[model samples]
Each structure stands twice: as structure tokens, then as C-alpha cells.
Target: MCGKGQLVTDLESGEIACNKCGLVSSDRLQENRAEWRTFDSESNDRSRVGSPTSLAYHDMGLATVIGKANKDSSGRQLDPSMNSRIQRLRTWDFRTKAHSSTHRNLLHAFNELGRLKDKLSLSDAIMEKTAYVYRKAQEKRLVRGRSTSSILAAAIYAACREMQASRTLRDVANATNVKRKAISRSYRILVLELDIKVPLVDPMKCIAKIAN
Candidate 1:
């Protein structure tokens, strides 16, 4: 191994290697940086300094909230009339975000998804996939008369299956406090409506997941 101290890190592969020798020093590097992708020059400049937008959020995490501080651009306290107007603006801003029935449904479902994510220690990919599945269900009006929690749980299960993540329906049900039967029913509906082809679960991965 050439120890020329010329090291290169491949973010895609999460590996650190020596440039001269092509020897990988580390293979499991944890990437803690913000997930930023450049679609265009203008967008790249505008989005350089924030958490990446995500589908899990109802607004895709791009919506801004009016600050509660009753101050102006110069940090001066606003007049009573201006303060009152700002307050109204803030209230309407909050209401308009979830004004639609679909928005409200997504708000509730994503709240549950966040909770289950923490409880089950889900990966970001699985969470995004779950959100996508839930959104598709909503778009098809398949969520009518169904419990949001059950549907969200079913989405999580489907995402897990699709990603080969080794999580079971019972596990998702227990995490979401939804009945297994309900999740199963919802899962079937999602698959039928969305035409999602779920992959077969690997028993070895399941055993390893359970053991861990």
C-alpha cells in the first residue's frame, strides 16, 4: 500500500481510498452532511444553505412560517397596527397550509409516520418511500373511509417490503398501534390500486433483523 497521504472519499459509495494506491481505507463512512442536489445553476445558488426538501413533509418542507417576534427588518418593535396585521397574516398562513382535506390528511399521516420512524429506527429511504406510497393512495382516493393510521402503516409495510428492509406487518402494526388485520387490508388496497409489486422478503435478512 502506498502511503502517499493522498486520500479521496467517495460520497456515493461511502468509502475513503488512497488516490495513489487505490486502496480503500474505510468502507463504512457515515455521511452526516446535508443532502443537496443541484438541478440547475439558479436552484443550486438558492438552495445551497438549508435542509434538503423531503416528500415526507406536507409542503415538502419548503413552506416558511412567520416568526413570532414582533419586530421589523431593523429589529425595531412594530407599531400596534402593524403587529396586529402580522398576527393575522400568521394565523391565515397557518390555516391556509392545511386548508384542503387532502392537506389535512397528509398532515395527520406524516405526523404518524414521524412517530413510527423514531420508534422503529427507520432509514430515510424507507420513510420517503412510505410517504410516496401514502401520497399515491391519496391521489387515487383509495384512502376514503379508511383509517389514516392504518393506511400509513400499510404504506410503511409496503415500503419495507419493496426495499427489502426486513420489517414485518406485525412490527409496523405494533409500532403504529394499528391492528395487523387493518394494516393487511390497507396494504392489499394500496397494492391493488397502485399496482405495486412487492418483493419477497428474505428469511435470512429477517432473522438477522430480529436478532439485532
Candidate 2:
């Protein structure tokens, strides 16, 4: 006969037995020990926040600038949109504060930003990229059919519209030393080759962004 909390078993002829409580057979228990090895000691430390030597950083100011550019001008927080473009802008911004360079380069970027802003189509990120792109084009001698200044202006205008900056072609042209006609022509060429998009700006979005 089995008592409380005990097991009863029948033998060949019909005998009964009682077993100890809370007893587990060794064969019925599971082995659950696990071993882990550390790889951190063997791996190289590869943590970096920004490319301090990159030209993009020399143009945009820092990652924060690019991040701010992606935000609504009203400074309200929202879900981050256009992650790819934002990253590109962040890279450009880094060039501004991280790189070692001359005042001329800094001045050049600032003037470029002013022109970009005047266009009502260019975003801060697009402006920075356009300047960086122009510098690269100059180094590669790939410029064609227009003066470098005009080409740069056109690129800036194109970048602004592509990245939804809120600038116009005429405005960017007026801000540059290059003639408006040349800027126009270069703009057409860039549009044809780069397939840039022109986006609509809604004041409500800006307001909603600001009001919050």
C-alpha cells in the first residue's frame, strides 16, 4: 500500500511497495550545463564614430547637422524618415567639424550653403553634398559643357530638389558667380543623367512639426 506522497508498485503476484518522496532516477534527469568561450579577446577593436579625415565631414559640419537637416525645421520630434539620405547628409556634415582644412574651404562651403538656402529647394544636406561632389568632379576633371562654378551651382540645385530641400533653380543660379543660363543648362543635364526627384513641400507638415 502506498502512503501519502509515495509511489506504490505491483510485483509478479500482486504485491505493493512504497518509495521515497521527491526521488529522481539518475537516468531520468537531464544534463543542462553549457560552456561559452570568449572571442572578444581575440578580435580587434573596431569602434569609430566618424571619419575624421573624410572630405564629406569638411562640408556638412557633423553627423548632428545631417540629422537636423532631416528633421522638420520647426525642431519637433517625429519618426525618422529617409534614412539613407539622412546618413549621406550626416556624413557630409561630419566633414565640416572633423577634418583639418583651410579657411578657404570653410568659406566656400558657407557661401555655397547660402546660395543653396536661397533657392528654396536645397536642404542643408543636399547643399553640402553638392559642394563635395563639385570638389570631387574638379579633382577628376570630369566637368563638361559648363564652367565649374556653374556646374557646381546646377548640382547644388539638383541635389536640393532631389533631397526635398525647398529651393529653386533660378534662386541657386542667382546666388552663384555663374550665369543663370549656364546653371539652367547644367541643371537639365544633371536631371537627365541623375534622375533626381522634385518633391512638394507642405506647410502643414512644417507647422505640425513646429507646433509640437
Candidate 3:
């Protein structure tokens, strides 16, 4: 970032960026569309909007959810038959969205990535990048017979490599409960299959990380 670092939006790619530095703040930002309205009521609830969509969810937070309650949306209690029907709807809705094998694999992998992010104190950007790498790997059929956690750890390691993050393989291996060899194998698979160009690690940052 430089100068005033004014925010800019890329219309084509939908990326939020800094105009001065050309740094993308977020690539998967949620779209916000507002239809103009005149609000004059005292109890006008404008701030109670729902959560923003997220890429981290298996469904990307786009799938509809039926809340577990005996009441309807207008706060009316349902009859016994209606209650069972709503419960079945909820169960089927969840199953319909979650039944994909790739989705389940990615869901588990992302959860593993989340735990590693917490343990290693990695930023959201790094986790997002790792997720991209993992998804790319899955797309290439590189995760067919491999451990999901191992592939996710390798994805995080590859992201750190690309970003020149000072984390070591031993560090990630310890934090992710995966073996160094497994991470290496998965990393190789990612490189060979995805044709990803993982940049060299910065020696100075590595030295500083070791000294710390």
C-alpha cells in the first residue's frame, strides 16, 4: 500500500483493491445490493441483516438453512404434523447440500486447515490461499487416495512457500498432526498436477524466524 491507499473496486473481477498499491484486499467478497427505501419508522431495523457469505463454508454460506424450532418464520407455533414435516425438510435440506463426496472431503480439509491456521497463527489471507491450493488439488484428482489433512497441510505449506512465509515443513508437520513426508508427497502432487510455481523461500525471513 502507498500514498492514501484509497479503496478501489475491480468491476470485472469483483476484487476489492487498494488503488495506489494495487493490492487486492479480498477476491471473494460478498455482493451487496440495496434497493433504496425511505425509512421513517422508529423501529425500522436496518442493522439486523444476515451474515455475509463466506468462501470457507462447504456451501460457501449460500445454502438455505431451516432453523430448528417448533414455530414458523412469523413466530407461530406449528401443529404436530407440521412440526414433523418441517423437521424432515430441515434434515433433507442439509443432506441434499452435504451429500457431495468432494464437498465432504473439502469440508474436512478446510476444518483441518482452520485448526492449523489457529495453531500457527496464520492470517485469513494465508488460509484463503491455502484453501485455493487445496481446491485446485482436488480438481486435479490429486486427493483421491491421500489423507485429507495431509493434503491440506501441504496446501498451507505451498501457500507459505508462494508467500515466502517463514514457516518450516517441520513446523507445519508438528502443528497439523501430519508427517513431513506426507506433506512433501502432497506438495509434489500439487506442483506436478496443478503446475503451480511455488516460489523460493526468502532466506532472510527464514533466518529471522529461526533467530526468533
Q: Which residue ranges in model 3 land beyond 4 Å of their true spot?
A: 1-50
Error of 3 at 60 (Å): 1.7
Clashes of 2: 19
Candidate 2: residue 57 lDDT (0-100): 40
TM-score, cand. 1 vs. native: 0.79
lDDT of 3 by residue, 1-212 (tens): 66588887643234678988898888744535433343557766554255555556667666777888789779999999999898999889878876989998878877777766668867655666787888888888888988888888898888888766777899999998889999998888888888889877668887877798
Instruction: Please provide, for model 1 over 78-135, each residue's C-alpha lDDT reduced to its tens digit, 9 standing for 90 to 100.
Output: 9999999999999999999999999999999998889877787677777888999999
Q: lDDT: which candidate is best?
A: 1
Regions more than 4 Å wrong, model 2: 1-124, 132-142, 200-212
TM-scores, each model vs. reference:
0.79, 0.38, 0.75
lDDT of 1: 0.84
- Please tell me which model should have the higher lDDT, number 2 or number 3: 3
lDDT by residue for model 2 over 1-212, one digit each (tens)?
32355644321112233465533222111112323345478776544334333233434333344445445568654455655666766777666553643434545555655654544433334545576655555444446444557766777776665554444555675667667888888777666555556567656545754676
lDDT, each prediction? 0.84, 0.53, 0.77
Instruction: List the candidates ranked by TM-score, beginning with the highest.
Output: 1, 3, 2
Q: Show pairs that collide, candidate 3.
A: none
